[model samples]
Structures are given as structure tokens and as C-alpha cells.
Target chain A: MLEVKNLKKSFGDRVILDGVNLTVNDDEILCIVGPSGAGKTTLLRCITGLETPDSGTFLMNGQPFDPQGTKDSDRVIGVVFQDFNLFPNLSVMDNITLAPMMVLKETKKDAEKQAAQLLSELGLSTKGDLYPWQLSGGQKQRVAIARALAMKPKILCYDEPTSALDPNLRQEVAKIILNLKKSGMTQLVVTHDLDFAQEIADNLLKVKPID
Target chain B: MSLNYVFEILPSLFQGAWLTLQIFFWTLVVSIPLGIVVSLGLTSKIRPLQWILEVYVWLMRGTPLLLQLIFVFYGLPIIGIVFQRYDAALVAFILNYAAYFAEIFRGGFQSVSVGQFEAARVLRLSYWQTIRKIIIPQVVKIVIPSIGNEVINLVKDSSLVYVIGLGDLLRAGNVATSRDVTLVPLLLVALIYLILVGICTLVLRRVEKRYSYFK
Candidate 1:
């Protein structure tokens, strides 16, 4: 479980996230639904250590969580960016295996084994040799997920996972999120689509822009 | 214009060409990596270091290469920092080319998107690992054409060693031209430069092709 309390963030004079509070339970899907510029992404970024919050406390299973720390936080919190920022220079296999081999000090054989497993699980078993630019949008999305999951983070966060997809792809993403939840993976998805949120969210949090 | 005269000066011109090649080869070997380090320094967070690099780049780029060569070979001895003629020319060439390459690499570094860095950060890749694995390959792809241009320039600029009385290709040609009172050696010198530049272009194109596997 992850808990965010009294989170606040501002850029220059404009406030984005103001005293926001939320909690995500283990093996649960928490979808943040809001219009554009509602700080939905900001909240996810703050939680994942991409953006710093002005004031907040993050607790993982009741222990203080520091996402920015160099310890286990990196392995504990994984994020999939909105655009699926896979390393363009690397093949899907390398993209999934890079962090595991480089940061976790896993042997290349072990990393490749785990990446192959993740790729198969994500329905990209045949696409591992291809580069990110060669893959379709949905395929790239799956690769990004595989890359994130290879790290074995305790909680996975998505920034507008379906924003760039078609309706069919959106349904596919919803199915994937539901499937991940079934496997006991905690997920926090930020999106503007209320219908999609309603389709998969075990709990929904609506954010409004701070005027 | 006669083939006989051309043959007569071929030996000396070849000797000069050898020196030119040496200067060009060593300058590239030393300066390319030095340029990368300087470019990283230019982008680094240390304010004073950045300022120093910026000023260094400005001084090197803003002035003439010819002037720098003269300063290193002639003027510096007045301040008791003296070097041999050949060494002084090399010092000037390396410093000048490094500055230009540094700017080119700095541009390459900036062209990479912020998302790449963020992704690497989230993956827990160390700073050096991130630079080596993620950032450098992309930057190398982006900067190849620009770096190729500088390399071609370096070939021609290596002739400037003639100013310090070094027996580089152009100096050899000049000496023969003045002694024999004919322009044949100068024309031969130009042809040699074209061949060198052509070879560089081919190698650079092959390198660019190798990197094209992704984008």
C-alpha cells in the first residue's frame, strides 16, 4: 500500500497540486481522473520522483517512502511515461533488460531471461528484436510496461497510459490493467477518460485545476 | 606543367605530406576525446567551470587559427613558455580543433530530450551508465554530420603549419614553387588535399550508416 499525505506543488506563481491526499491499497487499481492541466500527471510525477512536491509524505506499507533516495526506492516505484519513452537506440529486449543488468547488477543471461519472460507476459514475445520506432503505438506501450515490470517495482504508475491510443487500444489497455491487478500488482493510472477510469478503477480520485 | 618537374618534387612533397598526416592524426586522436570532456564541462552544473569553458571556447573560436599558431610558436617564448616549432604547431592545432569540436558536441548534448534523462533516472542507472548507454549513442548519431565537417576542415587547416616553417605538405609545395618558379607543386598539393578529404567523407559515411540501425 502507498499513502500520500498533504501533497503540495507549485510552479512559479501558479499552484498545481494543493494539499492533495490519497492512498493506494495493495493489489488495487487507483485511477486519477481529471481534465487536462488538473495536476493528475504532476501527482504521479511527484510520487514517482520525476517531479518534487512542495510538501508531502509518502509511506509504503506504513514506512516512510522516499522516492528520490538512491536506496530501494528506485526498485520499489516504477513509472511508465505517457509517450512510452523507450530507449530508441535499443531493441525492445535491450530496453527491458537495461536497468536490470546495469543497475541491479544482474548478469546479462539472467536479465535476458527475465526480460524474455516479461515480454511474453506482455504479449510481445515476437517483438523483442525490434526497435521502439518500428513498433506500433500499442506495441510500444506494452514494451514500456515490460521494461517497467522487469524491475519488479512494488507499485507501478502510468501517466495517461491510453491518451495516444485508439478506442480499441484503449479497451486493450483497460484489459491489461485489469489483468495486472489480478496478478497482485498495485497500479496507479492517471487519465482524463472517465469511462476508461470507471471500467478498471477499483477506486477513483478526481482532481480539479487549482485556480 | 611538365610531368618531369612533378616527379622531381614528388619525394619532398611526400615527406611534407607525411608530416601533415602525422599532425592531422595526432590532433584528432587527442582532441576528439578532449572535446567530449570539454563539452561535458560546458554543460556541467559547476558555474565557475562553465564560465571558464565558455570563455575558453569563445577565445579559441573568436580568433583566427593562424593567429593562434603564431602565438604558440612565436609570442609565447617571450613569456618563457617555449616549445619546439613542431610541438608549438601541434599545440595550437589541437587546442583550436578541440574548441570547435567541443561546441559541436555541446550542441549534440542539448539536442537530446529531457525524457531520456528522466527515464534513465527512474530506471536507477548510475550517472555514468546513463551517459554511456543512453545519452552518448544518441548524441553520436546526432552530431556525426557536424563532426564530419570539422574533420574535413582539420585536413586543410593542417597546412597552416607552414607559417611556423614546418615542412608540411603546403610548405613543401611552397618551397618547391619558389625554388623552381612554377605553380605545379601548389596544384599537386591541392589534389592531395582533395584525396584526403574524399577518404574522410567515405569513412564518415560508413560510420553514419552503422548508426542508422535505429533512426
Candidate 2:
């Protein structure tokens, strides 16, 4: 569902992602592993249009994803970063419904309805009224996933979702990812979890840091 | 010092306080929206916009309010843009306060994460919608304290109207002090200022509590 080609990115004199190419298929789970500073996150960010590529072509369902020229892409894609970029000012329901209300123009009632349903499924039903700071790391990750799913995107990109959590909490977050994978959501995850990379991913691409 | 003179002038002082209240309320009503627009312009992505906003902010902030008051009340007639002294002072105060509030508002807008902006963009929210629904709420919470500070400042600054002979609270107090030759009326005027500041502090403390997540 997503195609990335010859992606090149440089910060100042150092090249982070040099001539990287990857493809993500529909309903597929791909795990990308790399050493620190390997540009795995940068590459994922480029695909999600969080950062502009120095030179690359991104295609979603054969439609062009040109960051410089296009205001938006044709496909719906959601991202969950390692830092859990929830709006600290908004409640869980507000965070989850943000994109739908703003991007999709969903009414507040409809957005709240969907947010309630999704939060319930993620085991965050009671926490919907709470803000991000009130939640634990694992719960925040679940809210992040619910936020992405609330977009109803064709592809979900995760940038090391569970890396910040402790081992026990990591497994809890892993369960959420496993559920997404089972639900047939096309997901691209940049991760260091070898077990998840080996067991759950339909494809695993190991990336090494550039010299 | 006869105390009856102070009580005799109380009715006029109250009337002047009422005028001060009007000016304060109207200026805030006018200046806040003006500040938001100025802030949006200041943060515009385009270079020309950035330049224009930069110059506007610099000009408004660099000049003294007293000078700005004189310029509005007395200087504009050189180009035939004449106004009544009261209108001139009102315009000057609104414009001056708008600039400072704009900068404060820009800080508030900056506090929202880039992630939120990107999420709004990806969701296909129009730029206006993103600002009205997403950006404004965040900005409101962020800007409340500073805005409250400015609101209190504006209450005192309204006394600057005396420079233009608009007979605001300070001018009325000045007139009363000269006639009564006592310090109580002046102290009473200071008390009024204190009361204004105290009310603003209470309201803003409540606002800060409502948005304490920002802290």
C-alpha cells in the first residue's frame, strides 16, 4: 500500500538515509531494526511526511506523495512516535478525535462516539476523560494507537512505540500492536524488539547505521 | 483636613471610574481579536509577512506609550486624520496593547507541538479550522496568564488618558485633590487601582487553575 524509492536525506554534512528503498504492502506488518542514529526513524518519518526527504519518491496506492509540491497525499496514514505525541492539553477522547474532527470534519458527536468505542476496545474507556500526563507509559501508547486507528487510515506507522517502556509494560504495548496486526492494519514499525520483529512481523528489514 | 469634601467628590470619582471601566472593557474586547490577527500575521510562513509583522511589532513596542498617546491625540492632524481626544486615546491604547498582547499570543501559539499541527493538516482540516478549533484553544490556555497580566496593566494604563485631558480616574482624582487639599482622595484613588488589580488577579488565578495542565 506504500512505496518508498531511493530515499536520500542528509543533515548538514552527514547523510542519514542514503539511497534507502522499501515497500509496505496492504495488511502487512513490517519491522525495521537499526542501530542508534541509523536513520530508521528518519526514514519512517519521511514515509509519513513528518520530515521532508532530500530526494525521494513516495507512492501510496500509486498516487504521488510529494512533500514539496503536494498539500496532502491521497492515502490516509497515521503515525505513533516513541515519545507519544499526545496533545497534553487534550483529554484522551480529545486526542483520539482530534484528527477526525479537524481533518475529516467529523462532527463532535460522531467523533466522540467513535473515540468512546475505540478507547473501550483499547482498555482506556475510563481513562477517556484523563489527559496524557495522567496515564502510564503503556496506557499512553494505547491512546496513541487508538488515535491512529481513529483516523481510519489505510496504513499505520509506528516509530519505536514500546522502546520507552519497561519490559512488563513493553509486553502490554506489544499486545496492542499484535491486535492491530491481527486486525489486518498495514503497519510499518521501527523497533528494537527482536522477539516482536521475529514473531509478529510479516517482513523484517534490519538496517545498520551508515558510516 | 475636612473629610466632607472627600465624600462630596465621591459621586464624580465613581463616574470617572465607570468611564475607566468602559474603556478597559472595550479595549480588551477590541484588542484581543486584534492581537490574535497580529500574532497570526507575525507567525505567517511567508517572508514578506514575517517582515511586515516584525516591523509592526517593533514600531509598536519600541515607542513609548506616552509618545504614542501624544502622536495620536495631537500629531495625526498633520495629515488631516483628525479625531476627538477621547477617540484618539482609545485608538492609541488599543493599538499599543494589541502589539504586546500579540507577542504574548505568539508565545502561546508556539507552545503547541508541531505534531498537533501535522495531525490537523493530515486530517484535512482547513487552515482556518485548524486555527479556530485546534490552535486557538491551546493558545487561549497558554496565553491566559500573560493576557491577564496585560489586562491589569491596561487598567492602570487607562489613567494615561489624563495626558490628553480625557478626565479619566486619575484626572478626576487630580481635580479632587487640588480642591480638597487632602491625601485621602488620592489614597482612595490608589485604593481603586488596587481593587482593579485585585479583581484581575482573582479571575486569572481561577483561569490558571482551569488550565493548570500547562504548568
Candidate 3:
């Protein structure tokens, strides 16, 4: 349901993505793999409208994903940053429900219910009352994933979803992704972990790092 | 010291102290929200707006507050924008202190992690909603001490009202001490200041205690 046609991006004189094209079919786990400095993260950012491409276009469900000149573009896409961008000030529940309540115009009660369900499904039910600082890195990332899911987004982008975790925790995260695949969720995961991609991804796009 | 003199000076000075308290309370009530607004202006995405707000804050902060007071209380009347001396003093105090409070607020706001802001943006909270709900709550917790400092300073600074003959606590003490060179009455006024500042410190400590769970 997402398309990036001939996307090119650069910072100063250095090019990150040069004429890269990719498409993600609905209900598929699309793994974007490359070595370090492959612009995989930048590619994810462009798709999510967090960064503008220097050229080409990104379309989500046949509509342009342009946040630069638009009033509200963030509602259409959901992202889980590698660093786990949770609000330290808010409880896990608040962090998850915030987007649904504020942007989606869902009632607080409804948003809380959905958030609780998502957290429970992600094996984070008990941690909902706690802040990000109280959770392990794996738990925090799971909460971030729950937050992305709470929005009921058409496309879910995960930037190196399991990179920060220990080997044991990475398996737990992979299981969660595999479950999402079974449930038919559209996911675009950027990672260097080849084994995890092989285990969960239905389609793999390998980006080449330029010299 | 005659009990009658103590009674005479105490009653009048008490009234003047009440006036001081009134000015102090109202200055906070008006200036704090104004300070936050000015802070947002300085941090706005638009460069020209940010520049203008920075200049405004700089002009307000760089000059002596006494000069600002004189400019508002004395200079404004020269331009036919007449206000009562008390009104002029209050206006000057609010504007002058708002700039300082704004700077403190901006510092508190910036101290929040950039990641928190990105999270808020991704959640699609409007600029105003994110500021009010996420950013400001954290900022309030952080800026409590600085706000307390400014408020206590505000109590003493209320004495500056005497310059325009507004009859605040210091002015009354000055008049009382001039009449009686023994200085007991002035000492009483100083005691009153101590009590007020003491109460402020106690209140702020309670506030700091409530939010101390964070760090």
C-alpha cells in the first residue's frame, strides 16, 4: 500500500539515497536491509514524512505523503524510532493513547481501552502504569510499537526495531513481529539483522551503500 | 518607644505592606502567562518572529528595571499616555519581570529532551496542545525554583514602587524613620519583609517536594 518511486536524497555534497525505488504490498513484512550508512533509516524517514526527499515522491495508499507544505500530515503514518521515542514525562499508557485521543479524535476511554489491549498483546500489560525510565530497553521498544499500533495506521515503519536489544530480547521482539505478520499488518522494517529478516520478512529490499 | 507611636506607624505601614502584597500578587498573576507566551514567541519556527521576540526580550532584559519603571511611570505620561503612578509602576513591573520569567521558562522548556518533542509531533498534537499538555507540565516542574526566586525578588522589588510615591512598605518605613530617628519602626518593616519572604520559601519548598519524585 506504499510506493517510493526513484527517491533520491542528499545532505550537502554526500548522497544518501540515489534513485532508489521500493514498493510495499499490504499485509506484508517488507525488510529493508543494508550495511551501515546505507541510508535505510533516511529512506524510512522519507516514507514517514519525517524527512523530505530531494527528488521523487512517496505515496501511501495512492495519496502523496507530503508534510513539508501541508498543515497536518503526521496522522497518516506511524513510526517506531530505533531510540524508542517515548515521552519520559508520560506513563506508558499515556504515551500509547496520546495519538489516538489527540489526533484520531478518539475518546480518552476508547483510546485507553485500545492502548491497554495493544500493550497486553505486546506482552507489556503490567508495564503500562510505569514510565519509560522504569522499563528495560526491550520493554520500552515494545511500548513504542504499541504506541504505533494504537494509531491504527495504514503503514507501520520500524527503524532498526531490535538493534538496541540484547540477543535474548531480540528474539522476543522478533516473535512479536512474526505475530504481526500472521495478523496481516503492513510493516516496513529497516534492520541489519539478516536472520531476523529471513524469519519474519515476506519481501526483502537490500540497499547498497555508496562509496 | 510609645505604644501609641508603634500603633500609629504599625497600622499605616500594615496598610502599605498590604499594598505591597497586592502589587506582588497581581504582578505574578499577570506576568506568568505573559512570560510563557513571550517564551513561545522566542521559540517559534518562523525566524522573523523569533528574531523580533529575541529583540524584545533583550531590550527588556538588558536595561535596568528602574529605568524601565521610570520610562513607563514618568516617560509614558510625557507622550500623553497618562496612567496613575501606581498603574504605571504595576505595568512596568509586569513587563520587566515577564521578560526575566520568560527566559527562565525558555531554559526549562529547552532542557526537555529533543526526543520527547519528536514523540509529541509524531502523536500529532497541535503545537499549542503539545506545549500546554506535554512541554509546559515538565517546564513547570523544572522552573519552580527559578520562579520562586523571581517571586521572592518580586516581594523586595515591590519596594521600588516608592520611587513613584505609591506608599508601599519601604516608602512608609522611610517616612516613619525620617520622623523618628530611633529606627525601630523601620526594623519592624524589615521584620515584615522577612516573614513574607519566609512564607514564600516555605510554599516553594512544598512545591519542590511534590515534584521531587522526578529526579
Q: What would the DockQ be for model 2?
A: 0.41
Q: What does DockQ come to for candidate 3?
A: 0.49
Q: Which structure is stronger by TM-score: 1 or 3?
A: 1
Residue runs of model 3 more than 4 Å from their true location after superposition: A63-74, B1-7, B213-215
Model 2: residues with Cα > 4 Å off, grouped in runs: A11-14, A62-73, A193-196, B1-4, B213-215
* Tens digit of per-residue lDDT, candidate 1, span A1-211: 9999999999998999999999999999999999999999889989988888999999999888788878875358888888888999999999999999988889999999999998888888999899999999999999999999989999999999988887789989988989999999999999999999999999999999988
What lDDT would each prediction earn against the true structure? 0.92, 0.83, 0.85
Best by DockQ: 1
Give the TM-score comparing model 1 with the true structure, all chains together.
0.97
- How far residue B119's Cα lies from its native spot in candidate 3, in Å, is 1.7
Candidate 2 docking class: acceptable
Q: Please identify which of the two predictions, 1 or 2, would achieve the higher lDDT against the true structure.
A: 1
Query: What's model 1's overall lDDT?
Result: 0.92
Residue-wise C-alpha lDDT for candidate 3, range B1-215, written one tens digit per residue: 78888888898789889999999998999999999998888777889988987888899889988888888878888888988988988899999889998999999988987767766666667777788778887898999999999999999999988888798998888888998886878888999999999999999999888775443
Give the alpha carbon lDDT tens digit for every residue of A1-211 in model 2: 7888899999998999999988888888888987778888888878776678899887888886654333545546778868777777778888888778766778999999999998898888899888888998888888988988898878888888768787777667667777877788898899877786776688888888888
Per-model DockQ against the true two-chain complex: 0.82, 0.41, 0.49
- In the range B19-73, model 2's lDDT, one tens digit per residue, is 8988898889998999999998888888898898888889889998889998998
Native contacts matched by each model: 0.77, 0.30, 0.39
Query: By descending DockQ, how would the candidates be arranged?
Result: 1, 3, 2
